[model samples]
Target chain A: MVLLKLFWSFLQIGLLSFGGGMAALPLIQNQVVDLHGWITLKEYTDLITIAEMTPGPIGINAAAFVGVRIAGVPGSIIATVGCVLPPFLIVLLLVRLYLKYKNLSAVQGALSGIRPAVTGLIASAALTILILILWGENGFSTNLESLNFVAFILFAASLIVLRKWKPNPIFIILGSGIVGGAIYLLL
Target chain B: MEKRKSIYRKLFSSTFYISAFTFGGGYVIIPLMKKKFVEGLKWIEEDEMLNLIAIAQSSPGPIAVNTSVLIGYNVAGLVGALVSLWATILPPMITLSVISMFYSAFIKNAVISAIMKGMQAGVAAVITDAVLNLGSNVAKKKELISVLIMLIAFIMTFFLKVNVVLIILFGGLIGTLKVVLHERRNKGGGE
Candidate 1:
């Protein structure tokens, strides 16, 4: 029963979570934190960190993580399958539909409109994650006001380097992790 | 024949290795994929790769999975897609399985916490870059409407605690309605 519930919840997430991982965060937060109570808000924050650090799509990672938390290995399989199945099916169907209406003006217009909406969704998700990192649950205390400017600076520099030079993300991740750890230790 | 065989072998090996090693999911893989496919192998051109990314983004599956599938299909055939999908998923599945087995202990480690904090910053940077890059490409009207819808949805979710599914449904409805209304206006003007 629990496995079934897990499967259903993730299937909904997978089906609806268009765009990608960041877009999926709000939905996963609703399911994992608000609706089911499988994880707390803080744990959700931590899971986002873990998911970001781990490989794969954030949505899939969340499904696997939440599934495992709810049940176990079997739950993980169920949830992963549930999360993946919808998009696969949808895309397969879309492939055929796209072929048929490949030149339709309306299709083009709709897609054009959707393109920005997707961007907006992505931006909103980024904002949510930033808030979680900065404010925590209490919502904008003095501590958050301090705002870890150094981290933001590092983040901006990393962005420029990534865009211009295009370094290995693994190296960037590791390097940033070390810098963060050292900063924490120093503080 | 020998050249084709070598190409196939290269594609298989590269996809397999990337799938096995890639961590932190789709966004993380972008830089890696760009490195391997765009920079290293030159299997596909940069503009073509960007187009593929756009297609992947608009499509439904995980971006990494969709990208691997598309790139693989382009390089080899159905086999390439299968190989790439498997490769893309293999690392995370195996790693997550092991991690899940010991999740309790894993979550409590201070080192892990520190590392996670750092990774979060990196992830934030990556996400911000994605937004800016995509933002520039977005058609101007789409950008405005999209950002507005996004802001409304974000406020609703973060503040009012509305269900996300509902927000998506509303967004879709608004999107569809906008198109419909535009079409009607055009038709009325033409008439």
Candidate 2:
């Protein structure tokens, strides 16, 4: 029953998470954090951090991470299959049809519509993730006690670094982790 | 039949290496896929890869996995698709399993906890950067209707809290209408 639930929940995420990993963030967050109660909001954010550091698709990594935490190795397998199965089948079917009518204006037009919407979806997902990071459980508290200044600074610094140097992402991830660890030791 | 088997083997091995090694998700994996498939193997042409990318993005699922299935299908059919998909997901599944075994220790350690907290903020920023980068690129197309669609989709998701599925469907409807009207206008002018 547990395994089945893991598969079904991830399958929903897989089917609905259009665009890419970033776009999929909200759906995954909703399913695992809100619906299933498999993990807390903090744990989900931690999973996201690890997913970024790991190789392969973030969506796949996330599924495995959450699944293992919830059930075990078997859960990981089920969740990974659940996540991969939808797109695997759908894309195969799409390719078969798409190859036949690759030039149709109507098909092209629908795709054009999807293209811009995807950008918007990605932007919205970004905001949602930031909110999750900054706000946490409390809705809104302007007091410094509620805010995490260190995290906000890191967020802004990482953005600037990413835009300016365009360094390898793995390096940035590792670098930030190290800095974070150092800060903890000092505190 | 034998030739098909070799192609499958090659597909699995190549995808396995790429998926196992590439980090930072879909965008990073894509260029590596291009190099291997287009330049190295000559399995697909440059423009075809671009088209596949478009389909991969528009299709539901992870882009890396979607692209793998598309390329595998293109090369070796259904069996190949299965093989490539397996290869793409294998690394993460295996790695996460290992991580899970040590999950308690990792989470409990003070340094690890702090690092994760800090990294979450960094991850958030990186995501923002990606959003801006993708948005600006799409906006650069300078097509008014497409730009309007993008804005609408953003507003719908961000403010109205609309379900993503509906926004995508509505965008497609508008897209189809735009094309049909444009085609009619062209025909009427020509006649």
Candidate 3:
């Protein structure tokens, strides 16, 4: 039952993941965290980190990673297959028809609209992660005590450093890991 | 003339090599695939690879895997596409399997947990940068309708709490409508 659930959830994720990998994050979060209760929001963020750090397409890596966490190797294979099967089939089909309508204005029109929406989708995803860091999932409650000042500070610093330097994400992630270990561990 | 079997062998081995070593995400692998197939192996022409990349990007999947399958199909056939897909997936599966083997134990370590907690901020930052970059790209396109749709989509998800799948469907529909109206206007004016 668990195996079937994992496969089905990831298959849905694979089918509708438009725009690109990062754009797919919110969708992945919705299925794994919101629907299946597979991982916490915090752990979901960490998985994004791990997925970003590892090689291959982030979506496939994520399916494997999340599946392993849920149910081990068999789970991993099943989930990974679920995640990839849609694209494998879709792309093959698209390639067959692509040469015909490669320049369809209606297609370009649809993309133009979807592209901005994907930007919004990523923005919304970023906001959710930001909220989780700054406040609990209760989402903007009146409690100041639960707020993580240190994390907020780090988040600000990271945003600035990324915009200014554009360092590779691996560095940003590892650097944060070191600093996080130093501050929180000592405190 | 290389035997048909060698084509699959070449696809598997070379794709495995690139996918194994390449880090980050799909975009990172494109150049490497280009270098190997376009420059080194000369299996595909430079222009053809560009077309494949564009189609791969426009399609609804991981660009790396999509590109792989396209290049594979170009090289061999459907079988080649399947082989390339597995080739692309195996390295990460191997790497993540080793990591997942120790995942529970790894999560338990105080040091690792703290580090990950800190990295969460980093992750948030990286995502923020993506939002800004993507948002700005849309903005740079300078379309009033596009910008409005972006804002409306953001408000819908972050504030109104609409399901993203619904938004994607609606967004695509609106996009098609936008084109149809524009084309109709052009035709009417021409007539």
Interface RMSD of candidate 1?
Answer: 5.0
Looking at candidate 1, what is the lDDT of residue B18?
Answer: 66
Residue A71, model 1, lDDT: 87
- Residue lDDT tens for model 1, A66-91: 77778887888788878877776555
Q: Where is the poorest 10-residue window by lDDT in model 3 chain A?
A: A113-122
Model 1 per-residue lDDT at B1: 79
List model 3 lDDT by residue over A13-126, tens digit each: 888787568778988999999988888888787677666556677788778888888898988899889988988888888778755675799876766666676557557756
Arrange candidates by TM-score, descending: 2, 1, 3
Error of 3 at A85 (Å): 2.5
* Strongest candidate by DockQ: 2
Listed per prediction, chain B TM-scores read: 0.59, 0.62, 0.56
Off by over 4 Å in 1: A1-53, A62-79, A134-146, B1-81, B139-191
Predictions: Cα RMSD each? 6.2, 5.9, 7.4
Error of 1 at B145 (Å): 7.5
> Fnat of the models, one by one?
0.39, 0.73, 0.65
Clashing pairs in 2: none
lDDT values for all models: 0.67, 0.79, 0.77
**Candidate 2 per-residue lDDT over residues B1-191, each given as its tens digit:** 89988999999999998787665667657656766798679999854775576678767999999998899989988888889999999998998777766865765688766776666676676667766766776778799988898899889988998867687777778989999999999999999
Q: Tell me how far candidate 2 lies from the true structure as C-alpha RMSD in angstroms.
A: 5.9
Candidate 1: which pairs clash? A54-B24, A55-B23, A55-B24, A55-B25, A56-B25, B19-B87
lDDT of 1 by residue, B53-171 (tens): 54566666577777777777667666666666667665666566667667668888888777677766766666666556655655354556766665676577666756544565456
